[model samples]
Target: MNARALGLLLGYGADRLLGDPQRGHPVAGFGTWALACERQLYAPSRTRGTCFVVVTTAPWVGLAVLATHLPASRTLVTAAFTWAALGGRSLEREALPVHELLFEGELEGARQRIRSLVGRDTSALEAPDLARAVVESLAENQSDAVAATLVWGALAGSPGIVLHRCVNTLDAMVGHRSERYADFGWAAARLDDVLNWLPARVSLLATAAVVGATDGTSAARRVLTGASRDGARHPSPNAGPVEAAAAYALGVQLGGLTTYGDRVEDRGQLGDGRPVSVRDIRRAATLTRQVGLVVLGAAVTATAMGGRLRRR
Candidate 1:
């Protein structure tokens, strides 16, 4: 296998086995640095936000470029970055506990646990709403944290993955519709939208492909139908389709009124079937794993083909 492809697989394997590092995670460290920079760089101006992005992300991305150029260090660096960038296992770990809490009828515990997974308010959520939150987070994050990371890593090696993660992190930090961030987060939000566009599609299709492979064509059609009907109605260009796909794949409804602090959004109806239940969360987790496997196989196959073509 090519070094890039090998590194990608190694990193994915490590993530599967180890989850994220317990301490000193590079992404966590980056978050700290970015927060410090934001204090000094904060402004309502888009220009200032743009500078913040450059200052925070450029150094790391530049280092990736340099390290990737070294034959001896390329694969190791790519593997390390890929492991840092992907969060599928952590997504599962965090999500399933909410399921456990809900299963045990610990509504308050579920609500508290769910706060770690979603930005939406959880204190008043009932079981159905709590289930929806976890499922929705799983669906959206499957693309944002896993598929996108793999796509960029395959396409541009270490620098591509790092850039995508940085932009995404910045978006998560500042991309808000609130008065405080509407202007300052514009660039990060826009850049995140652009970078995630293709990855979201890939995730949507991968979800359908897995469903079709296991459950046959009729089941898969639901995945496509859900996206076609409701994907555009949601606010995020990337997340809407992915969540819609998951909603159908698991045969549950998602996306309705969501509360983030004082803000309320009508996320639109995403799928057909009964309202989401705690059981659906487990199903969503399984579907996420299947989708990740499919993406991994596809990336490795594509990389191998490209390497062969170059040699020939």
Candidate 2:
């Protein structure tokens, strides 16, 4: 298959897998699997830890890809693996539900849900802060979770995608600064950063392109330039552009303080427009959907061109 055809196929496969409730619900299982793999492979020595995690996860990703070559069952396996790797409970869905509680003035319920979704204390968060946190998470995850995964899957096929998922899972599991993973998880964290580096930028550009097409090329240029100038300020190398582009496209501020455990991190903000609100959060989702469609269309066009060339 050509790049575009593969991309379209991958996108359709991902959408179908994500939309299916039975398959989608198992996302947590994938998370659990990744965590389990991390714990099993986590050696005390940094070198040993890195080797163990890489060796273990690589094969699993490869196996997942190989399974895609199977007959009629390949699609089901691919769908299951994708759902497990990428379909789990997201901050986006969780955020809205929590927001609803808060909107009804149920502060305590919102606080509880927020605590569950994020690792930080939410006792002191106001409604706006809660909304901001949700929006930022949604924006960042567009690169980390959705876009990156789809691109990886498209390029590398199922195995490549599975491998990406495994690395991401490892990063999420042990990538944080805590007593347990501070040293050992370093390799996994760095690897995840490296893997996501290009894809993140591509996702930002894709978002910019879509915005420019739907809005104006000037708006897209502004978003891209602003992202390039300011994205590196965020803690993550890959997360900045996605968050920045989303904020710019939606015309709202994102980023700032995020708490983890007892420590509070002051992250650089993206965009200087209005403060984030539920409407903005919804708009971000809409943008994500639009970006997905853009990607799908591009892939389809590319695939068709390739087919024509082959025929010629």
The most accurate candidate by lDDT is: 1
- Runs of candidate 2 with Cα error greater than 4 angstroms are 1-27, 33-41, 73-84, 88-92, 115-117, 299-312
Cα lDDT of model 2 by residue, 124-221, tens digit: 88887887776676666666766666566555556766777777777877777777788888888898998898668867888898889878989999
TM accuracy, model 1: 0.98
- Per-residue CA lDDT of candidate 1, range 1-312, in tens? 888888889999999999999999989989999999999999998999899899999999998898888777667888999999999999999999999999999999999999889999898999999999999999899898999888898888899999999999999999988898898999999999999999999899899999999899988887887786899989889899999999888888889899999999999999887899889899999999889888887877787678888999
lDDT of 2: 0.70
For each candidate, how many residue pairs have backbone atoms clashing (under 3 Å)? 0, 1
**Pairs of residues at least 3 apart in sequence or in different chains that clash in candidate 2:** 65-159
Worst 10 residues of 1 by lDDT: 69-78
lDDT of 1: 0.91
